[model samples]
Target: MTTAPVRSRWEEQRSFDELGRPLRDVTFCVVDLETTGGSVGDGDRITEIGAVKVRGGEVIGEFQTLVNPDTAIPAFIAVLTGITNGMVADAPPISSALPAFLEFARGSVLVAHNAGFDVGFLRHFAREQDLPWPDFEVVDTVKLARRVVTRDEAPNHKLSSLARVFRSGTTPNHRALADARATVDVLHGLMERLGSLGVHTLEELQTYSSKVAAAQRRKRHLADRLPHAPGVYLFCDDQSRVLYVGTSKDLRKRVRSYFTASETRSRIGEMVRLASSVTGIECATPLEAEVRELRLIAEHKPSYNRRSRFPEKVTFVKLTREPWPRLSLVKRVLDDDADYLGPFSSRSAAESCLAALHETFPIRQCSDKFGRHPSRSACVLAELGRCLSPCDGSVDSSTYAAVVRQLRDALLRHPDDVVELVNAKMAALAEQERFEEAGVHRDRLASFVRAAARTQRLTSLTRCPEVVATRRDDGGRWCVHVIRHGRLAAAGVIPSGVDARSYVEQLRVSAETVVPSIGPIPAATAEESERILRWLELPGIRLVEVDGEWTCPVRGAGRPHPSTATS
Candidate 1:
């Protein structure tokens, strides 16, 4: 017979015997519970119990009992769990079953998966029954599996998970006897892995533990310092060139979390080396801060931003008041003719703004060009009072166009005007002794005020009627602008990797989307295009020389803009 080792509680807790040397000793209980879906409270009781006793990594005894839950099993649980009301009808109550379990598990560590849920039921049971809750140290095999199992390499980590890990394919009975035995099997599997990792010392095993009690105290200190509010945050390098920008509902507390440094791959430490200091921009609400943070990150594309998208490179509602007036997002900038509505930070942002405008001004944003679609009556939005109903013929083209213009001016050019108008109305209401009505206007005005304030505007853009975007423009570099009205909407550069002249279809794919002709102005005539030709004397900017053809110069190298480049 293979003689198994024996263990005492002190060996389980301390690893070393009185000899002061490492002893492979531990006392563990593989425990399982069957409950009335059963209650510890309100007269609910345990339906069954099963457990195995293991010491020094050897199972020496087993225990099992069925307790009357004193009630019907919940229908859903009964169907899935295979444990029915009849099995517990003649069994002992929890009062008797629990004592047997305590005697069997004396002086051993408990092991379970998702341990807290099972433990909580027992804790509540004891509290309700006026019994002192049983206490024992525990090790969650689930958390242990997380550290040892090679995620995809292992099939799973449930009792069945461990079964497969160790090829201990004991058929799953799920009965108290079967589950208790499976748990014993699981503990053995963990011991094998733990032994393989040379985890003989109690101190060593504790180091890798996912102990909740210890982690909670540490988190408490971290939370006390983090401000519970809304704001923007910055991760900066030593020189203060922002590496990443973020906004949160809370300021101080979010920044404070990095110092705990418990896990290597968590939030703060991953980005800490790139951060020398933190900066913040506080906003009154999460909504406003989220919107602004998006816009700022897009415009800056801070090097350390983990998120994969940019702001200014967005789809927007471009309103054009030209040959035939209408609204839609333009994807090109042929020869600037109409004004522009956005370089909105996102397509959703653009759409949401359009929805708001539709409610206020009744503008159309659809692919069907003006007068192109027949049966020119009001669109669906008109019936909802969200639109002016220009398509349905309820409103004429001139009136529709005027409303579109007002919305265009309000969103892109001057948002403050809407705020001013609402504020004026609110003031008049207060003067007329209509205080309640005035309050409504006051709230509406605040929204407009905040919206206007949130958008970080590029100043004095009105002077440049024809907006320009220049990015090397060698067949490799593409300069594009998506415009709104007759004025500049948004402009930027995109470096296409292909050579300038070859594969012209893909090469000419406009980074520029145009809306209503803004008519190209002298300022946008590509002074650099002319200057580069004069200096380099090359035909079309040569971004790359591919297959004997020329491409844009800025393509593929992933170089930063001149402004962001270090000297």
Candidate 2:
């Protein structure tokens, strides 16, 4: 049997379709430096600074300064440049020259024949002298020349060779100012070559000569019409099938990044190449965008989305159904009669919550298949007063069931009892001068409270049968979301300059309906509940309508106003 060839998924696309700022609009600062000796690490110092700032191919500013190297010049260097220790005796120190150079070069792209050498010295001195180093974007003419002019066109990519080839007005004389002027002409010449290739933006010019394939550059038009707003974007293939779904605060910026050279993900590049068009669903707030992203990922199950697709993967803490029920952290919730505390963020959090509960309650610790009559030996925890000793038949089932009820009450009904018990134990420990033990109790109490608060906040959203809310978007528009049974059911935008009252009734009728399960608790996973709760907590969002009771605790674990709530 023959097998089909495996096609590569990584596609290369343009960073953006719309041409960004033109090269003429950008400012370029061509710089050059002369050093006392070789390496700065070997105690070498900068002797002379020269730079020419240009905009639209015209010199806008110039910076030149001679500095005392604070060391004697070598004999060979003095003969080469005709500068000696006596020549620079009246010149200012590099510390004084660097400030003026940096100010002149501010907000401009630094260009040099060999940029690394020049920029490295400046950076090293800036750090040593405790001066603010200008974080300038740099372009190396050497690298750009290598990509633009081949060996046949130019024997070498050196500044002098390029200067002779391009016929730059100045000739190199081993002086900083003359070399910098030559570099400015070279920079403009290279930019002209880049402009012929349709490279306009600074980003495009920087990555223009990259090894990315021509096909990748052609795909730059894919993200052309995407809105620059907070929203979920879908990448659809030629068949109009959704290949990937993503959420971003700025849809255009994020999507455009996939085509740039900086995008390192091979698979994402492949996915983008297969995609023919990109569509964005705008939202009023980031929270709404995130919720929509989660919902779409779950609904579409796109080939590229790997997270939150399996809602069943969420971990839950529940009591086992048996004569001697024990608190257990489980991934799946069964139909068996058992009380649950979460859909926690992780199994470790559920385990931590279980440990906190165990610290206060005398529940069973062993995970044994308990029989009608006890036959197993008692563990060390029973002797230490940790467990009720159900394995040894020391504790009756009825008494254990009553303890289970209290555990359930602490987890679900009211977490205040647990908080009060921990507080009292901590107070007793402190009163007895057992400060170390009291501190341990305090930390465990804090962990328990934090976990409980997160749990209750999420659970409150699930408990609500229906929720309707609205928030203002960046464009002065209102967005409405209708959540049904803890899942995002519908979302619509209300444009600016329109009376909200006129559209609210029609939107409410068109909103999707979800019948809540006729049970004491809402049916939802941790991911779904958290998504809904996060959307509700957005700033300036107002709860317009609610079908069922949805509130945090008044006395215990998940209370919003903990200061006012009594322990």
Candidate 3:
């Protein structure tokens, strides 16, 4: 005959151990309390107690008791829990039985179906009887069940219902011990499900289990090898092709989160399942990591990554190179010498920018690819005074060129006049209660402001011959990057207790020639330039070098404060 497995004091005390301990090492007490009535406020009292002590998924001990409540058990509750009043009449009072139950459950994390009900009853009894309540880490099977099992898998998150789904060995019969037994089975099943999602530690299981699906948990192994550092991570499928790319200051934590329910993106679930491995490229700084992520997404065009995937499919609002030079939305930024405003996300946004410009400057709206001469006939825009009639040869070259210069100045240098005009239109429309039209005007102004700010920032960065900035990293080390023309040319780390000047000079000389090529004006895209600018604006970052002037308007559209200008 096999003797019962022994539990050492340390093994039993595993609940108080360091968090993230393996699930198999922690002790759990599955408990259930049968009460005479529905709620404690109604003077209900626990009639029976059932608890099963489990370790490593196997039941090693049990605790069952009956407590005389000093009140008659309600007939319906008596029939429901099948614990008659007579059965508990001769039992020990709660003051005596509560101590015994506490002793049996000590040094274990509590598990129960609808744990709040059981724990609440225990707390009430402990308070009345003047008994101390142990601070037990509780796990609710009901909560775990709702997360791990879907409605189709189980009709509802009830103990009896889940018992049927999991096919618990002991059928629940409204008896405390039997229902508690069923809960033990349910708890084990949920633990098994959680194990697949890399929830090896009790802390991870308790924190993430309710939010993670089984499929997501299954891919937790993919993130196991990632380092906890600032870096870019790539998820790859069986074919070793990149499926998704992302950046994180803590690579391990971020990549691991994708395999949990916390990652609510519909496509991410599929991405996690399809991914077989995760590859990490550590960076000295978060800026370098972000830049690397942008480059990787652009290069791989990963199926799961939505943003920064196809920077080429963006629209640019450009002034035509012809003598007429109407504002045109073009797909590609050619070598032609024309003022370009965009790199906008869509053609509609580019159109909004153009409309905002039109509110101030009367540039042509026609899509004509005109020669040195203009179109023979004036379009409807000319009739509406919307265009300067440049297409109809109504506006001369020098006259149109002056209008083009205004557009350029408003876009790049000073947008105060255009901003004032748009604000007046929005306020006037709002006063007339043409709310929808006002909304359109407001969006146009906002689009112009955002485009103007982005354009100005990008232009400033690209015009600089070279830029060097530094931020303090862990251990007081310095993370440095050398940017040239708004592109991340090179990056390096200056370890603590070392001279940074020599290393900085060396890194700058050997920096890579990564040209900016995404946006129309800059060699880089708006997104890339924005990333560099954001990094430079970080609190500890200091601009160490600048070959060209970088400036912003003191009272222009890009200013942070709202403009109070009139039409």
- Which candidate tops TM-score? 2
Q: Give the C-alpha lDDT of model 2.
A: 0.76
lDDT of the candidates, in the order given: 0.51, 0.76, 0.78
For candidate 1, write residues 82-185 as lDDT tens digits. 77888778888777767667777777777666567456666665666677655787767677777777768577766666667766635445566667677767
> Which rank order by TM-score, best down to worst?
2, 3, 1
lDDT of 2 by residue, 1-567 (tens): 011111111123434433455677789999998888768899888888999999988999888888899899888887776677897899999889888888889999998888989999999999988998877988888878887898887888888899988889998776789899999989888988887886777877777645565666677667677666677899999998989999997776677666655456777778877988888876645666787777788788888888867665556777777878888887766667676666665676667667778977888877878786887778999999989898988888899889988888787657776677777887899899998877766666665677667667766777787788888766566777777777666666665465776666566677666666422234444565577677678798888899888887676576642322223
lDDT of 3 by residue, 1-567 (tens): 011111222333333223346788899999999988779988888898999999998899998998898998888888787777789889999888899999999999999899889999999989988888899999888888877789998788988888888879989887888888989998888888877854677767666745666776777667666666678999999999999999998787688667654666778877888898999987766778888898899999999988999887888777766666667788887766776776798889888877888878888776667776765888887798878886678978888889887777887778877877888887898899998887777777778787777777787788776888888865566778888888778887775555778877777878876555443456566687788888788788877777777766665556763532213
Candidate 2's TM-score reads 0.73
Clashes of each: 53, 5, 6
User: By how many angstroms RMSD does model 3 differ from the true structure?
Assistant: 11.0
Listed in order, each prediction's TM-score against the native is: 0.34, 0.73, 0.66
